[model samples]
Target: MGKNRLQLENHLFILPDYLNHPFISGNKLRKLKYNVLEAKKQKKETLLTFGGAYSNHIAAVAYAGKEYGFKTVGVIRGEELADSISQNPTLTFAQNCGMEFKFVSREQYRNKNNPLFLNQLKEAFHNIYVLPEGGTNALAVKGCEEILEEADAKFDYICCPVGTGGTISGLINSSFKHQKIIGFPALKGDFLNKEITKFAAKTNWELNLDYHFGGYAKVTDALIAFINTFKLQYNIPLDPIYTGKMMFGICDMIQKGYFDENAKILAVHTGGLQGIAGMNTVLKQQNKPLIV
Candidate 1:
């Protein structure tokens, strides 16, 4: 399942089976593997990371920490969850995985790079290994290199959605032979090309920013409807936030004659299907039928 590809209409290819790997089950898993290994190598007793309320990174860190027997701390963005919380399945699962949650205000969380912030966290948790938010550290990039070896195929272009740029950077660096490696940013106004090139430095690949329909986490009725129809037609589920936007942009580009008919496009399905839970409620409230 690691080398999966689906030739969708208009020359767009989807690699849905990338989600099947135990360690590479999702983008977060791929990013976490190297970080966890590094923490072990350094003999770190605790793993400290940052993420939003619904972050996949938090979930991945929790699972990885448990597997590695390292104490885990999640510097969660936003207010604390209620005493008897019901929503946020991922957070609940992370808690169950033995991750200690620390809530910080949005303003304080934004100071992630400040020395004071690091000192404070260190004071609270001694010998803690800090992983950047979303696991967008150098180690994460090194970890992402495995993805290219996993997908050993010759293709004109390799595409994936860009968030913090770790996955895209890692893929681009590892896929030096690929003709083009494009990153479609899900965030509408995000300057991902600049961010990617800045973080990855002097890469020999084209960064395409033509796909974001609106902005990060932004979904419209048309987008939701497209996800539903696409799933019904192909029996593949896509979360509205990430892969759905990426597939939408890929097909849109194909229809617009962006790629040659013979072009071999490999769309990396960076899995985050767990996000669909929130969208499901929205869809049902709007009386939209579930595709599956």
Candidate 2:
């Protein structure tokens, strides 16, 4: 439960940051820490952010806003989700935290960053502090940079799951020159390289694109089995959306002899465990095995 690294096997370690908090743990905690501070510093009374129904960022922002005395609004992606909040654990938790919802169509949600679209949001929610989807702004990256400690310097490679590129960018900034930062992206795309370049100060990081299993939120039976087996073996739970895929890739790479002999690897466990219930719901509908 501490910040100590949990060694899974020889030379493979995990930073159990998911234990940082029961809710806003892992990279979500790191990503939100300074953003919340900046909102308070700006004297903002309301925090507005965007995310999918099962988004960890939305859940984190809602809890952080409640804990920090700010009203929260979540611009959820799927409009139909509004009526099904009771069925979705993540959205239900956010609502219980007093987070207001603004559900939009998938088409409209794509314009979430559009200037005119944002202006409409500004008009609707006055005096709001806006956080981007996945909460990967510069301030969030600043918070993520602190995830690595001096003790982590001994690691030859630092690894984490990449969402909107904030956490990995922070790792890239804080990593030693000799340490290679490896990212396993949860979403499929070649677009992340450019996104990471926007905030990362170093060129030491690289993304392993082979293990997404599919696009965002997509899962397969093999991934589910790996996640369940991994938890049974290591007693460490990894969320399907991000950490699970990243861990699967790292393990696959090790089996394929990707890492050099004696290479020290630190894999960061960025939490999204709250999404498990929702994911299990989807798996049940598909008659697939649950993550457990």
RMSD of each: 2.7, 1.3
lDDT of 2 by residue, 173-224 (tens): 9998889999999999979999999999989989999989988999998999
lDDT of 1 by residue, 60-152 (tens): 788788888899999887776534235677678778888898888899899888989999999999989999887887888887767765444
RMSD of 2: 1.3
Q: What would the TM-scores of all predictions be?
A: 0.88, 0.98
CA lDDT of each candidate? Answer: 0.76, 0.92
Each prediction's number of clashing residue pairs: 2, 0
Model 1 misplaced regions, further than 4 Å = 21-24, 80-84, 150-153, 199-210, 281-292
TM-score of candidate 1 on Cα atoms, chains taken together? 0.88
Error of 2 at 185 (Å): 0.5
Regions more than 4 Å wrong, model 2 = 1-3
Judged by whole-model lDDT over C-alpha atoms, candidate 1 comes out at 0.76
- Top candidate on lDDT is 2
